[model samples]
Target: MTVIDFTAFIGRLATASGETILPFFRTSLSVDNKSSNDFDPVTEADRAAEAVMRRLIKSNFPQHGIVGEEFGNEREDADYVWVLDPIDGTKSFIAGFPIWGTLIALLHKGTPVFGMMHQPYIGERFSGDNGSAHYSGPSGERRLSVRRCASVKEATVFTTSPLLMNPDDRARFGRIENAARLSRYGGDCYSYCMLAAGHLDLVVETELKPYDIAGLIPIITGAGGVVTTWDGKPAQSGGRIIAAGDPRVHEAAMKLLNA
Candidate 1:
């Protein structure tokens, strides 16, 4: 199938997953810990949404593989793979926050070519292909592009938390944070969407799994932003990430991160 065909399917995929997720949004649903500690949470919403999306992919394109946070991997050697993070921000979701969203991405031969982030409660969807990006919400449809900033000191920076990084990385992050004029913490995947919308300048995150960032790369880059590993390489594998809406911001931030 052509990209247009897959794009149409992606729209439906997000809608279907959103339908399964909305009901559990603000409910007193039980949350189970997926990590060894009680902090990392997983709700039925995460699993149910992933299941619905997985079912759709398997039914429509059984040849494609799937890498999901909840269900694990299947048919990974296939040329096309669907990456799903049903609730990209479960911590915020369980807190009754609207910033949480579902993430979906398609990788062609292991290279991401399409991505979408959908927040059902907020009625927002951010989508992009390799060439362009767009936003859909109550305000209606619009194109997305990042704003230009000459330097990191003039930019607004964001990170989920310095705590997400190891102690050494945290100290390295502090150097960059100190350089930025403003630093806001804690938005998870939504922070990247905000950066693409020209509402923020930079986002640095660490120790993320592939599922945490697979859907965000396209949205940012298609909007004229740049995303890379802290060492100034592709972030496709999703470990240490630094994304900037402006290239200059990226250049300045990377210096501090790599220093």
Candidate 2:
């Protein structure tokens, strides 16, 4: 299918997921512990949204595989795969924080070709393919590009939360945070959108799975941002990801992260 054709499907995917999720936002719903430590929270909304998307995919593009946060992979070996995180920021969602959104990505032969982050509550959508992004929100629709802030010292940084990091990763992140002009926490996927919008300069996080970062790469890169691992490799599979709005800042941050 052409890029235009796939984008139409992406739109429908976002809408289906959002409809399933909005019902649970700010309302009482069941929360369960999925992590072995009983700390990683999953809610009914997360599962319902993913289920809705999966149904849509199975109905429309039955050959395309799916990798989701709530449900395990299905036909992952398929050349065309859809990576999904229905509630990318489950913690934020449960906390009534608006920073959470749904992440959707289309990967061809294991490389992401399309990505989108949609927040139905705020009526915001950020999407891209390759290295370009477009945004739609309460204001209007516009193409986005990251602003240049050529140095790390002039940069503003963000991470989901220090608490989410292990001791070692936290220490490593601290070095970068210490170098940035300002460091804010608790943005989840929203901060990545902010970076794409040119409001933030750097974002570093560890322990992310493919579903977490897959949908963000295009949005960030499309807006003239760079996303890579801590050591400066492609971030498609998501390990320790560091995204910088400027290449120089990304280089500097990588130095601190690796040092």
Clash pairs, model 2 backbone: 131-222, 132-222
- For model 2, residues 85-181, the per-residue Cα lDDT tens digits are 9999898899898889999999989988899999999989999997689999999999988989878789999998888788988998999888889
> Which 10 consecutive residues of model 1 have the lowest summed lDDT?
1-10
**lDDT of each model, Cα atoms only?**
0.91, 0.92
Residue runs of model 1 more than 4 Å from their true location after superposition: none
Against the true structure, candidate 2 reaches a TM-score of 0.98
